[model samples]
Target: MRSLYKIVHTTCQTGWGEQEQRIYNESVWMENKGHQVVIITPMGTPLFTRAKEHGFRVHGVSFKRFSSLKDYGQLKQIFKDEQPHILNTHSKADSNIALPAAKKTGVPCRILSRHISDPVRNTWNNRKIYKQLTHFIFTTSDYTTQHLQQVFKLKDMEIFSMPSGIIPPQDLAPKESARKALARDLCLDATTRFIGFAGTISKDREVDTILKALKLIQSQIPHHIAILGEGTPDCLAELKTLAKDLGIGEKVHFIGAKEDVWPYYRAFDCKVLAPGNKNKIPLEGVPLALLEAMYSSCPVIGSKTCGITDIIVDKKTGLLFDPQKPKNLADMILDTIANEAATLERVHQARELVRKKYTIDAMGRNIIRIYRLHQVKIARQYLV
Candidate 1:
């Protein structure tokens, strides 16, 4: 018989980005598999509201830094009341409060999920939080797991690199149809070819790299790039200015954030992720967008850095280019456009990889296996 576990997930983030979406999707997966799932987030936040609407038991606590005494108290109480078999914290602020509460309340399986590839400083506080407070750590990518191992000198078994998985779409519109629909919405001609980017619009994301690459090939290729996400107003303005200055403003369409991006992925001639590598802390994890794009049978191009490399296998599954060089990206985009047979071959390979490994079912089952292992270990300890 399968043992059903009550799992409590905590995240401090208010935004509905990839991390929050992962938590929600995982919670839904857990629930469907007969587990009782609880969410703890700040009151009135998007996650809190969404979880509540989805009929999960939710507790709202302000996870503010340094003044988290109230948050800690509330979490400790919730831990005692809920007695969850697994307590998973998703962000630093939430982890700081919730892990200790779980520890004091004797939660058997405490986990801290690190979602980004950002570098972790080896501070005493960090050491205690990562190594002492949590029983196991879940990172979104191997790069992050290895980085944590180096910083904390953690054993290999103590950390798991489990990227959030996607549910492969069942009924997607045909590529040409999707393209024509998107073109109509964007007020472009049905024949217009689109290169697409669907992620947060930030400096670290390096959307400008795509713009620069587009500028390089615009005259020759005569294609438009649809950016299907938003950023801070300043960032958006700056990008628009850069596009204008490069004389490709008309070619770049900032579609802002969309409720449904799968259509955009389907509409794309090729999808790109171009996160820069200059930051001290790496920002990209195994990006879910790229996985979705690949599963959509869209050809993908990514900067050869961070977790982007984990999915795009040079020229096999997808193409990669140096983020530092716009020409490299331009050349790769041109290659994807020019080589129809090669690009389609890579797209098929990429889709197969996603179906085999990157589905939500795969991730949920693996995580359940980990939970069961810990449950057995705890039982043995109790018997002893």
Candidate 2:
């Protein structure tokens, strides 16, 4: 029999966003594949409940967002109890304590999943800690593995890459109903095309720039933008007010956080993302929102950054625009609207790419392959 216990160390719940989605989907799919999968994380009540809700067992370790060692002891205790053949860690916190403990316990194999492209603020020290891990896993092709190889000074092959594929819902909602609910929220008119964006929309989103471009865009084309997801409310309101100042205030809708974002995608004719790279932390590694939009066959337009190039083939799979040029972004949106057939073709290509390359069944198996390569297989002897 083979079993694996995964410690997702991220201080977040599944279904919320990227990391959560990856953790949840991988664990659930692995369990369905007949592996005894258990997820360890601090947000126990929710993560655990959701895991069981999805038909998998979960182990919770108390964790603090800023401190990786906060759950060190609890994690060690779980390690002893579960006796997982491999200690697979997702969060840096789990790696801080779990990696070394796995070595101490003679767990045989310890692996770390590096889902973030952005450099951690404390990366100087974190790289040193990463050296202890048995293997490193990356979710996208552009993780700067060579840079990490130089910093960690390990073999070039020590770092491995495996990007996250899309995880689609069992059903998609009706198009007209989804559009009605969304259009009503934005008070959008029949003439206005709603360009929707989901996930983290921080100031770094250059949303102000998007708002600025809106003034120019509205002159040529009437459109509404919906920026959804939770964050600093004051900051978000400030962005909305910026829209008002730009005379596109009412046109730019800022809806706060969501538990379920599928309908949001269905409502959108095109999905846009402005996640930015900041402080070495590249806002990347295959965002779930963009993947979901692609599956829905919604046209995707994004800034060319980090792992985005691996997924988006500009003018082929989707359109790419310069992050610094709001005018370019606006023009791309206009072009997409005017060239509906071409934009729709991009959507078709994006969907085919996702169905072929990006999906839980596809990516999970790839990740599982690496985990199994180093996984310990014990033999039992029988005496007659």
Candidate 3:
């Protein structure tokens, strides 16, 4: 077993996405097992500050993506000071900062986890670093690494697939009251069938496609959409206009964002995720939002992108729709509503699948195994 000092670095802690959440959640879990997991993140709010004060260590560093050479060199000083046994960097940009630090400190394990599958940053310089400086390039999917290899020729035994695991959203029967209260606050009819969606509804979401689909189906069914996200003014305005043009503006309510999403999940009869490919850069992988939705006994409809395919089994646990077709989203939504038993049975299976394969505890165990394997390899290398 490795010592109780494994330091990881990322950008910040204000945003509560999978990338930020997992890094801390896994860190805390490892800490519980007597390991110290320090993360190099920017400042957090009072709540996050309190949590850190309790036990977990948070190192503040202003490491921006478009930073100068001095930024990386400054972070390198942290590695030298900490002398961490393992240095795990979350993003590729952050990897750029952590790379030299790991090299200069001679940290045995420097793992870079690729959370997104964007091909834009799969650069020659990064590939060379993966070949030479970095210890391993840990990716979320084999499909992701395959594309990276095809485009940038970053191939190695060191490149491995390691997905972030899903934690079942907290269960709350009393929380049902909170869901009803939110509906009341929104002025939604007590009888309306509410379908919901929650994610980064930016340009990549293509939520207008879902809106068009909702328009197609609204004439036949009495349903409401409860959206949960915030984005730029332009994208948000475009979505509002799309809903207004579809004649369902009043029926669709934008909930923006909430710290606790379980209440929203309980209020939703179904969940929808509509993602568009940003250029050829495929947005693939099992998103935690979909897993949380499924875990909450809600059926789901997702796009056929590689990442989402890992969890969504069409007509089984959830439905897969063509992102380009307006009617496809409508058809799937209607079908999911029509077959409530099958839809719910799929939810049950999805929850079970997550329990077996995608729990945070399972992910922690896998990560520990990977660390041990790498450590053993390191030990044999310098026995002379």
Candidate 4:
């Protein structure tokens, strides 16, 4: 018989980022499967709002810093009262607080979901905290899991790799209707071959590369660039200047973060992900946005990176580009536009790939399996 578990997710994120969506998807699936779930986030934040909108039990606490005593007390008290089977936390601030609180409250499973590949500062305190955690959950496969194990030296700790899952759109509108709606909103012509880049507009995401590539093929293709997601005002301004410098300022449109980016995916001819090398913590996971695009039947041109490699089968499912070489990205864009029939075929195959391997249902089942396996392992250790 399947066991029902009480799962609590804690995060310090204020925005509706990948981590927030990931938890929301998992919680929905687990709840349907008879698991009780609660999400703890700061009040009035986008994540908190979305969790409430989705009917998930939510607790709002300040996530201002790592050492907020008041918030820590509240979190610890909640853990004690709830007595959750699993306390899953995302981000460093939440993880540090939740791990100790879970231990103090005698929570059986304390899993820290590390979403990025950024190296944690190797300090005595951090090492100590890492050693006490019950398990580490990595969103990416081998790259991040192996890197963190080496960094934190968690040879004995249990770890699991679960890629972030996306809920596919239920009613996919036709390409013409989507393009018409986007064009109407953005004031572009219907014939425009819209290229899109979704996710945060930070420097690490390399939105500049998309702008530069658009400039390279501006004369060759009747195209416009639509950048979705939010970023710091300074970073947004910097991208605007880059667009002007590349002489494609008018062709590039920044439609700040949207509650729904599926329509944009529907309108895009090709989706692109270009992460730069300059980031302190480089992009390393299979981006949920990439999976969404693939599921929407939009072909992708992703940088050859860890997570991207796992999904894209180089020219079969989606095209892979070198982030360092802007020209490589430009070439792929032009090729995708030129070979429309072949690109559509690839998009179809990519959709099948996402359906088979990356749906929310699949992710939920895998996570439950992990929980059960961990329980059995602990039971065996106790018997020994």
Candidate 5:
């Protein structure tokens, strides 16, 4: 049996996205494996409330500033009380506050979970801040990890790549049953093949591009699309209007944000993840949603940009499309429907890959290994 250790995780975000979910999943798994896990968050945030409800020891601290003595005092008190073996902080806000508190309390291991592919600024201040950390766990193996290593140049700290894991779908109804439920709820046509998308309908999501692709293919192939996320009212209205203008308003269904999107995965014949809009310094990573869809046995069509290619080896695990071209996107979708056998084969491969590499248990075990290694390193340093 593995020895248990206390782990403290902090995320200072109000909304619950992939980062929050990753923390929750890993924390639950760690607790179940006999490790003590506590979550620190701002009071009444979704992450704090959910962590509490799920039986985690949660400390709520509203941090005004990273340098605030009051905030530091509160966090230092929590660290002293918990004495966690590992202090893992996610996001810029949480890390800013948590790092100082951990340092003050002499926390054994400091781990930063960098979930985005945003570039790390190569400034003296940024380097100083990063040098204080002992480890980095990046969501992407390629961009974020490489960028940080080049910029931070931390000689002592270890870097790890661990993608967010999927909670295996429990008690998922049969595909036909799920599709029927979706049809009943969303008033979708039973006969129509459904293409699914389950991310924010923002510019980065390229929801507009998907709508345009669907328009190009509508005359060639008729399909229903179920969008299962939310954005601002104006953004949502714009997408709806765009669909209408493309003569696909009737075929497209915006189901808004869903608390449970797993069941609806069964309703999709094929899922599309359009490429993100490029920025000066593009921020992109493998979306956890794509992995979840794969886990649900849904064959995915993802854009070639970003870390998507890391998992999707075009026509192997999933199909990749050029997001810049709407016609290419249309062809990929059409080909997926026409080639059912190939699609199913790809889905099976994806499901197996996810099961092997991307489960909460796998992630927790890998992380625990890193924590142990860090502990050993710290001990060796003290001995020397």
Candidate 6:
């Protein structure tokens, strides 16, 4: 018989982004697999409400940075009461509060999940948190794993890289059907070709590069670009002005965030991610948007940087371009359009890769394996 364990997951983020979604999904999967799961987040956040609605035990704490004594005390008491087999912390603020609490309570396995590729400062407090309080580290990409290792001089066995898995849609609409439905809703012509950009609409995402590339190729291909997801009002206005300045205003459609993005993925002729390389640290970690698009069989194009390269693989899985040069992105877009058969082949390969490696089941099993290994080590130590 398999061993059943209780797991506690904590996060400080309140928004319903990919990171929060991953935590919710992983918790649900574990619960369904006969393990008990609990969530600790700030009150009234989407994650807190959703987990509560789904019938999981949940505790809310303020998760403040400067004045976190109350939060730490609450977490410690909860850990003592529950005595979870594993305690996983998702964000920095929560980790700062929960890791020490879990350690004090003697939680058998403590994990710190690093979800972004941004650099970690080599501070004394960070070292203690990562090296002493936490038992093992989980990173979303090899980029982050190597980054943490280099910064804190952590050994390979101390950290593992695993991208959050996506749940494939059960009933995906046919491509033509999806395109026609999206066209009707967006008031576009049924025959209009679409290029898609999903995820946050921030400057760091480099959406202007996509707009400039669209301007360069509009006359040649006669395509439209759909900008999905929402951003700050100022960011939205800046992108709109840039599109108008480039004379591609009418061709660019900004459809804010959608609850169901699968239909949009199915409707897209190609999906793109164009994060800027100007930041001192890399900003991506195997983007979930690209994974969803690839699973939907949409040909993808991304800048050759950071975790984007982990999935794109240039011409094999999808195309890659330089974020610094809009013309390079334009050429990649044109190449995808002109070579339909090759693009389809790449899409097939990409979808297979996501299925084999990036599915929720795969991630769940890997995590459980880690937990079981730790359990065995603890048992051996007790025997000795």
* lDDT (CA) per prediction: 0.91, 0.70, 0.75, 0.83, 0.81, 0.91
Candidate 3 Cα lDDT to native: 0.75
TM-score against native, each model? 0.96, 0.85, 0.89, 0.89, 0.94, 0.97
By TM-score, is 1 or 6 better?
A: 6
User: Candidate 5, which ten residues in sequence have the lowest lDDT sum?
Assistant: 132-141
For candidate 4, list the clashing residue pairs, or say none.
none
Give per-residue CA lDDT, model 2, range 56-77, as digits (tens). Answer: 6566665555555656666667
Q: Please give the lDDT score for candidate 2.
A: 0.70
Candidate 3 per-residue lDDT, tens place, 1-384, comes to 465556665543356677777776777778887777777766664424644776766666656656637667767777777777888887656676767767877887878787788774656787666666776777776668776667666656667777777766565445356557667878765566688889988878878887888899888888888899878889899899989988989888888978788778777778899887777566855687887787777788998775777788888878998888979889999988898789878888887877876778877887777778787888888784
Candidate 1, residues 1-384, lDDT tens digits: the string is: 249999999999998988899999999999998999999999999999999999999999889886699888889999999999999999999998899989999998899999988788999999999989988899988889899999999987789989989987778789999999989988988899999999889998899999999999888897899998879999999999999999999989999888777899999999999987656556768999899999999999998887888888988999989887999999999999999999999999999998888899989988998898787777788899
For residues 119-139, what per-residue lDDT tens digits would candidate 6 score against the true structure? 789889998999999889999
* Residue-wise C-alpha lDDT for candidate 4, range 267-310, written one tens digit per residue: 99899998754344456677888999999998899987767877
Q: Compose the digit string of candidate 5's lDDT tens values, residues 66-136.
A: 44677778899999999888888887877877887898898877888888887789876566557765455
TM-score for model 1?
0.96
Worst 10 residues of 3 by lDDT: 42-51
For each predicted model, how many residue pairs clash, with residues at least 3 apart or on different chains?
0, 5, 2, 0, 0, 0
The most accurate candidate by lDDT is: 6
Task: Score residue 306 of candidate 4 by CA lDDT.
Answer: 63
Superposed model 2: Cα runs more than 4 Å off: 1-17, 43-45, 52-57, 63-74, 120-128, 144-146, 153-157, 174-177, 185-192, 279-281, 375-384
- By TM-score, the better pick of 1 and 4 is 1
Q: 256, model 5: CA deviation in Å? A: 1.3
